[model samples]
Target: AQTVTQSQPEMSVQEAETVTLSCTYDTSESNYYLFWYKQPPSRQMILVIRQEAYKQQNATENRFSVNFQKAAKSFSLKISDSQLGDTAMYFCAFIDFGNEKLTFGTGTRLTIIP
Candidate 1:
């Protein structure tokens, strides 16, 4: 079974600053996908970034990036130049090729302080 663990329950960052939320997972499967989804107060899931397990390089999207350590089963999200709009609950998810369902972490609530 693959399980994601978000150690930080809550994190706060000042606007225009940077913050990194830690996430770790345990998976025996070699082929899988990792994702970071953000849910604002509206409760809509937004894809922040994604990293394929077979890919060696990390993935980046605008101000969002990921530190994907496949060997350590750790995937963390880094938000650079954080903005007030980035305030939301960030969840780490993993999808195994065998199963289409996504396994998500408890989530880390991020608050961008102006």
Candidate 2:
């Protein structure tokens, strides 16, 4: 079983700035998928980005990116040019290969200060 941990429970950043939310995980499985999910005030969980444990390159999506350290089991999300629309609860998740079950962190609530 895998477990995700988001050390920061709350974070605030100025609009148009950059912010990074940290996340770490523990898993016995070697191959898996790591994900950063965003839940806006609207309460819809959206896929921000994903990283494959077997891949060396970090995964990125538009303004969102991840710094994945496989050996360290860290998968932190970096948001460049933060915006008000980015205000939300961010969750880190992990899925073992072929298991399809996702283990999620408690989440970090991010506020974009104008």
Candidate 3:
């Protein structure tokens, strides 16, 4: 069984600031994929970044980056230079190799304060 946890239910940060959304997961699988997804007011889920458990390198995309601690099963997302458009519900997700289903965290609602 696999489960993802997001400790912070809601958070707010000023525009242009940096914010980190915390996530922790547990899985028995030796190989898996960790991901951060963002859902805006439109309710469209967007992939922020992804990390392979076999890879030691953290994943990054533009202003979005992840701190992936494989051993600790911790995957946190850092959003730098936050923008109003960045306000959304962030989810932590996991999926083992060859698994078609994904387990998702409860999510953290992030707001960019003007």
Candidate 4:
């Protein structure tokens, strides 16, 4: 069974600052997919970034980026120049080859202090 872990229960960052959320996972499969999803107060799940296990390079989207360590099974998210809108509950998830279901971590509640 593959499992994702977000060690931080909550994090706070001043507006316009940068924040990094930690995430780690345990998976036996050599090839798979990793994802970071954001759920705001509205509770809508939004894809932040994604990384394919085969790719050694991390993924980036605007202010969002990932540090993917396949050998260590660790994937973390970094938010640069954060804004108040960035406040949300961030979840790290994984998808197996055959299973479409996403296994998510407990989540890290990120609060951007304005």
Which is the leading candidate under TM-score?
1
Which segments of model 1 are wrong by more than 4 Å?
none
Cα lDDT of candidate 1 equals: 0.96
TM-score of 2: 0.97
Better of 3 and 4 by lDDT: 3
Per-residue alpha-carbon lDDT of model 4 for 8-113, expressed as tens digits?
Answer: 9999999999999999999888878999999999999999999999999999999999999888888999999999999999999999787888999999999999
- Model 4 regions more than 4 Å off: none
lDDT to native, each model: 0.96, 0.93, 0.95, 0.94
Residue 31 lDDT, candidate 3, scale 0-100:
93
Q: Can you give the TM-score per candidate against the true fold?
A: 0.98, 0.97, 0.98, 0.97
Better of 2 and 3 by lDDT: 3
lDDT of 1 by residue, 4-85 (tens): 9999999998999999999999988999999999999999999999999999999999999999998889999999999999
lDDT of 4 at 47: 96
Q: Distance from true position, residue 99, model 4, in Å?
A: 1.6
Model 3, total clashes? 0
> What are the RMSD figures for all models against the true structure?
0.5, 0.8, 0.6, 0.6
The ten-residue window of minimal lDDT in model 4 covers 93-102
Clashes of each: 0, 0, 0, 0
Inter-residue clash pairs, candidate 4: none
- Model 2 lDDT tens row, 3-40: 89999999999999999999999988899999999998
Score residue 20 of candidate 1 by CA lDDT.
99
